[model samples]
Target: MTALAATSTPSQDLPSLIERAASMLSGAKTAAEVLEAREVAGLAYDVAKRAARLQRAKSAHDDLVAAAHRAQAHALEIEARAKRRLADEYDAAQARGEVAGHGGGRNFKVANGNVETTTADLGLRRDQIHEARQLRDAEAVDPGIVRRTLDERLEHGEEPSRAALRKMVVDAAMRGMRPQRRASRRNPLYVAPTPEQAAWRHVTGVFRAFAEWASDENLALARKGMREAGDTPFHDLDARAIAQGSAAFTTIKEWFDAR
Candidate 1:
């Protein structure tokens, strides 16, 4: 209460002495005003506590946001894995013939009833859009138009094979050389003819069949030839061995031509 010692004038003491004295005074005053100062300091401490808690909460929120992003990335990875697995399963199932059409040739209808196809399996998105245009245009024509147009276009061609001509004459009699007329013709007897006549007859029958088939525009001739080559008498013959045995007489054509 000595007027707080004139509050110590700045010029009254040396700088070091003044600093030391100021520290001693502050310590002494804090002890004397302990309760009052404690209340005020407590308020500041409370403010710091709240600020620290707010900082911690902000940090925790940032961590949660980061975790959410990581979870989202994981979900995308899982989705990609599922898509690849489904694609592989689809390919395996197709190989085993569980689905219809050529093994890898058709569009896929997914489990969700959505149509999706790989670029390799069918058209890409852009290609599908283009093909859709063709389909839309074709749908405008009659269903039978393509076949009818082809038949009419080939009507004047030379008569092809029996199997072929039959296709061309879609509505006509099944057999040509009318049945009654063929019956009256002189029939060749089973008795052996000259070798020249025998070979000629066989050759004539083959040529006639080929001509008729070609004229009729029958598309199955190549398949029929391959099928016949694999069956019965022709397949059993050692065509390969025969070719290897003689160089000058090599190959099916050479063997037949040499004879």
Candidate 2:
């Protein structure tokens, strides 16, 4: 990460940060430089998102919010490009016998030459390489899906949330469809939801829906059914069962706490 990426506080200088990262990635002479540029781009995206949220909360001008979102979209493009670079470099490294891993991939064991840095030496994970390739291929197939998703949200008065995009990707993957690609546009940038992002949307969606369904009255009736015999087994929410605390409350609380 560079000094630009170290920006912990929200600043309007996200454009500069993104520009620097793009320059670094384009001019990168080494894999490390690509990684650094990606890191900065990631930071730029995060900071711009926060700024957009802050502006919305303060009821600032709509233009300000839209500009921040545009910054985020651009930053994502740079990050995707970096991923492509890293993927290509990893392939080249494998050919040069510069990548050492536990299992053979693309090639059999080339006698370990202690002469140069390996994939492990540079702290590159096999998973990252695969994910980078996925992003690159996704762009080839779908064109400007990454930026278009964000810009669409801005135009539609949505929050421009990354979670929403991840959810779309997961859903698309489930249905064996490419994610939200239009034939009219094309661009080099792309993103595919990681397992972590997919899992997040899954867990949060489950919790949200469950919380609404498991209201006090509903739980109370279910409790009655599980408890005493023909005691109507149903009642309205007087807040009685919830206020006094019951087996159903304890069970739900425990499950929620575990989560």
Candidate 3:
């Protein structure tokens, strides 16, 4: 459905190409299609990255420039799957002794880990492969983290750079020395949330379920009657529960009023 599936070059119009990248990802219905979508997205990210570098010189409005950076961030996020797939394929090849591990990283079959097909033979540098491995490892922990951090930086009016992203990843890794995660958290990268971010996240997370529960049909169901165990509805409103909920709401109202 797209011409860029086989090519790396993207259209000159950054916004239009961003749309295409998004469309490719959404339209993908098969594994092969998904891989192709990653390719297109990677191309979009590359194009947007370059275009954004000149946005200041072009004197674009702040919003427009930020939007472009965000598009780049989104595209890079989509391309993460491609990074994992590439690294996995390389690792499998290394396991099979078809290629050496980049920079002598790992290889089960080959002792020296040197093989016939070099990364150079495949037209990739050691550093590129190493970066791919890093992306793969990080994504395995928390998908879309790179894009999220990039967008976070842009939202704060900071220049988004590879160094910044690397620092974030490294910082998160360093925080690994913290105590083990609670059962609820299962800490992915150990990146701590700011106080404000944590508060907002807690509010949204709680309200999302509360909103669904307060929907019209649910509210009616809650008031209808006690549901039978086997032959009736699963959930029935209890007087004690309702009282607790009312008390909770009042407490929240008071807290907000105090604020």
Best by lDDT: 2
Clashing pairs for predicted structure model 2, backbone only = none
Clashes of each: 4, 0, 0
lDDT of 3 by residue, 1-259 (tens): 5456445464345545655665666675433344566667767787767767778789988755765676676566666655556566666767776565444433323223354334443344567566666766564445446766886887697666657766766665665522232433555556656658655565555567578768898777755633422232111213344586688768877888999
Candidate 2, residue 57: how far the Cα is off, in Å: 2.5
Which tens-of-lDDT digit does each residue in 88-152 have in candidate 2?
A: 77767766665544423333222243345445545567777876766654544455555567668
In candidate 3, clashing pairs total: 0
* Residues 126-230 of candidate 1: C-alpha lDDT, one tens digit per residue: 333332222222212222222233344334332112233234333232323111212334554434456576455655554465467764346576557446546
Candidate 2 wrongly placed segments (more than 4 Å)? 1-12, 101-123, 159-259
The window of 10 residues in a row where model 1 has the poorest summed lDDT is: 136-145
lDDT of 3 at 203: 56
* RMSD list, candidates in order: 42.9, 22.0, 16.0
Relative to the true structure, candidate 3 reaches a TM of 0.49
Question: What is the lDDT for 59 in model 2?
Answer: 100
Q: How does each model score on lDDT?
A: 0.35, 0.64, 0.59
**Model 1 bad stretches (over 4 Å):** 1-61, 97-105, 109-259
